[model samples]
Every structure is written in structure tokens, then in C-alpha cells.
Target: MTKRRIFMAGAMSGLLLPSIHAQTGTNTRIRNLRVLCGFPPGGATDAVSRRVSDKLQGSYADVSLVDNRPGAAGRIAIDELKRSKPDGSTMLLTPAAVITLFPHIYEGINYKTDDFTPTSTACQVQFGFGVGPGVPSSVTDINSYLRWAKANSGAASYGSPATGSLPHILGVLLANQSRVALNHIPYKGSAPGMSDLLGGQVPAFSGLLGDWLPHIKTGKARLLATSGKERSALTPNVPTFAELGFKDLVMSEWYGFFLPKGATKETANAAADAIAKAVRQKDVIDAFAQLGLEASASTPTELGIRMKEEFRLWETTVQKLGIKIEI
Candidate 1:
């Protein structure tokens, strides 16, 4: 049988396809493909996954779907993905947080870095620090914000989607570097924290730029600085944290594709090529750019290296901050 046929059968049966001993001399035609994500339907992860999935569907003459399996800060979805068949048909599209941060913060996670093989990275989502308009800090830059917060008597309050998340670690890192005290308030997700920020219940929040862009434009919130090293093309006037004197504050949240571990190299490469082609389309690039996310693609090896680096970074940060959970 052809490699594609073998992969499809293995996907349906939840079994691994043995390595092809010789070249098939024919390209594999993908049939049904599922890309799993670990966030709610309307969140950033879901949005990007759907965008990529739509483009792939149009490019490939095959069935493609983006599945949402949000829970446990993405551990639930990761667990399910790990259990999936090691076939190209079943894959995952998840944020770096799920692989790099979640495993470090939470206990009893169902999967680890070894559970999957990298496919290709899709895009980089920029994060920013935003505050409600009511704050009188007059902090248009990161340095000034730190100065103003340190001068204040009480700990400055900030919000994040969850404890030990990228934003949370960034907040702590910023506080440590600036010698300022920040009171971190954790929320279940970005929606609730954003709600509190708009309602004047919280002074500031750190999250995806798209999540707070509307509020910033409406005068309900003011963006202080972004974590991305360079200013975003969509909001070039907004300075990066490095530009404002916080040199170590640069970071971007990445999203990428993964297949269940043990998939044949040829199957993984085919899937990655399909995804890279989909992401390269002008329509897909335009859609992601509109959300302040830059479109980029990486080989499986490159993604694997990135995951390892991010894992090390998160482990160090979590240990330093004493961030932990009871599972």
C-alpha cells in the first residue's frame, strides 16, 4: 500500500505506520486531517487554528478540521493529542504556553515534550501591557511606568489570564528588573481580566495585543508598551519594552503544529509542507497581520529547538518565582 493509505488506516485505527523501507516514488494525498487546539472557540489559539485550517482546506484537496479542546490551561487538550494516533492525519496546533509553560507550572500533566513531533510554526503573537485610562501614572514608557509604580506606596495591581502564564512570568520579571512591586491578579482567561480592566476593577493587564486593541482605541485603555522587541507593523507608534529601557523584556508567544510522536518522517514533512503552503498564501498572511500577529513558518527541527529553549526559560523563571500548583 502507499504511504498515504497506510497513514490513513493507522489514523483510523490509532496505530503507528511502520517506516517505509523504500521510496514510494509517488506523493501522498492527504484525506481527513484534524488539527487540535487547546483553547476555547473564540480565543487567539482557536482563531489562528481556524484561519490556518481554512487556508489548508482550500489549498489541499482533502478534508481538514480544527478541533477545540480547551481546559486545564491546555493540559486537557495536550493529553488528548498525545493519545492520538501517530499519523499525519491527527495533529495539534497550540501555543508555546501549552508546551513550555503549562508543564512547568502544573502537576500531573498527561503529556510532555516527548509526546509529539514538531511540524511547523505558524505565527508569532505579540503581547502588550495595557492600563485603564483612569490611572494617573502618566507612564507612556516602560521605564517611567516602573518609576511611577515604585514611587507609589501600594503594590501596583496587574492582571493575567492565569498564574504562571507568559504574562504572569513577564509581569514578575518586569517587576524584578524595575525594582517595583506588582500585585498580580489571576483570572481564568483573558476575557474576564479584560472585562475587569474595562470596568475599572483592575488598573493594568498583560496579554495579546488583539485582546486589548479595541479598548485601547476606544480610550477605555492605554497601551504602555509591547513585549515584542520591535514595534508591530499594525501599531508602529507603540514602543517596545526594550525601546523604553527594559532590555530583557522582549518576548513573543509562538503557535505551531505538532504530530503525535513516532509518525514517519515522510508523513510529518508532507503535513508541514501543506501547512507552510497554507500560511504563505496572501489571504492567510493578511488575516493574521490584521490581528497584530506576524506570519512565519519553521521546519520541524527548528520548532523542536525553539520548544527546548522555551522549556528551559520557563523552568528557570518558574523556579525563581516559586510559581507552582497542586495539580
Candidate 2:
């Protein structure tokens, strides 16, 4: 009848269960967790979501799923996340731009930065400016490329994942700063833009580095520069925009996790712990590297700070660029 004996009896039976999830320090169990993704399957965003979902399967929920609702340039998934409950059962994994940059560019987005709770970031990827056979082989670096673009104004164009994406913004910055007349060709996704780049339909492409890796290895594409403070590890041979005297163009996109706005701090911390653990694993890091992404984690507070900082930065940049989406 002693307390220790009674506790031992409960532990021997199933009465003292659910404490097993205490390894994450939170006792909440999400029976059917759905990680909403705005991109389709087989894309970078979906891959990140699935990788984190794998690690969260047993620890955070009995089953973890990635719900792909790709449409309206990743707005569909965000809409779904807005409608989801705050019980920690629904989570969203998306690029930081969708939350930070979209609001400034899109005319009628229903969600705002405050609509979701920042949980943690899964990975970050740098954008690359590359050219395929469309450009003259002599155009090797950014300076030469600018010269060529300036001379061949008719053929001077760059394709990005979308009109309002970070890559698009970077392209616009490059064109304006360099005083060139480069046109923007926005594709629905990186794949199609990459396809056009490889086909010589587009002389230049600005997108995630992963989209250019395959062609780069095959000698079909050449990376002129990347959008990062330092050179990207994947393409160290290529200089960064900052190195090329584009100090204002240093940027990278991070994919972050989120919950409904009303989720409590406990739930947010639990999800962040699981995501941080998931992204730090050796396999996850290697996988992200193959995808041209750097696997890293951040606290809820850190993620929130990053979101606010990037949101304000984008607001100013977008307004300055005067770029807006019709739909």
C-alpha cells in the first residue's frame, strides 16, 4: 500500500503510460498529426515535411502525414493551416517567404504573419543564378553575364519559381543594381523554370541550387553566382552576390514549421523539440545536403524573430521593387 509500491504496480501495468512521451518533455499526444505542405510531392518542401514527419511519427503522434494542397502559389496550404485547430494535431511546413514575402506581393491573401505560431525551422537553401546553353559560353561570371545581358537586351531574361518568390526578388535586384534591362519570366515552380533554362528558352534561371545541380554536373548549366553572404558549400567555385559587390542581395530561404495561432507554448515547444531533433540527425542532414539544403533548427523564439525580421525586410524590398501579383 506504500506510494512507491503503488507506483511500481501502475508502472508494471499500462496505467503509468503516456509518460514515455516525456522524453520530449511534453505529455501531449497527437493521434493523427498532419503536416500541411503547400508544394506537391517530390518537391523540396514536401521532402522536408516528410523527413520531419518520419522523426515525429512515434514521438509526437501515433501517425504523421504530409497533406499536399498545392495551388495558388502555395497559398492553398496556408489557407488550410488557417482553418486547422490549435490542438497540436495540425502543423505547417513551408518556405519562410510564403509567410514573410507573400503578404507584400499578393493582393488578397487572407493570412498574415500572426495567423500561425512559429514552431521551428527545418532547413535553409540558397538561391543560385545559373545559365544554360542559352547564354554565350564566354559569359562565365556575374560581371560578364551583366555585360552580355546589357548588350543582348532582347534575350536578356531570367526565370524564377514564381513572380513574388525570393529568387524573383533577387533577380530584380540584380537587374536594377547592375542597370540592365533583364526581363522576368516567372514559372509555376522551379522544375519548369529549370526545364526552360536547360532548353535555352530562358537565358538565365534564378532558383534553389538543387534545381541546377544535376545539370551543373552534366555540363549543361553554369552557376554564375548565389544569393548568400558567403559562397554556398554546394557550389563553392561560384561567387556569391555579396562577393560580386552585391551586398544588398545576400539572402537565403528557410523552411519552417508552424502550428495554429492559438496553440499554447507547451505545444509549440513540443513541436520545436521534435523538429530540432529530426533535422539534426545525420541522415536528415545528408538528405538535405543532397537536396542542396542545409539542415538546421531554431527555437520558437528564434524562428519568430527571424520571421519578423525577414517580413519587414521583404515589405520594404517589395515596395521598392513595385512587384505585385495579379492573382
Top-lDDT candidate index: 2
| Clashes per model (N, Cα, C within 3 A) | 0, 0
Off by over 4 Å in 1: 1-26, 58-61
lDDT of 1 by residue, 6-106 (tens): 11111222332332222346355556667787776777788889888887764442666776766666765666677777756677899898898878777
Score each candidate by Cα lDDT: 0.77, 0.85
Reference-based lDDT, residue 230, model 1 = 86
Q: How many Å off is the CA of 212 in candidate 1?
A: 2.6
Kindly report which residue pairs in candidate 1 clash with one another. none
Question: Model 2, 34-54: lDDT tens per residue?
Answer: 888877788899999999999
Residue 187, candidate 2: C-alpha displacement in angstroms: 1.6
lDDT of 1 at 206: 88
For residue 95, model 2's alpha carbon misses the true position, in angstroms, by 0.4
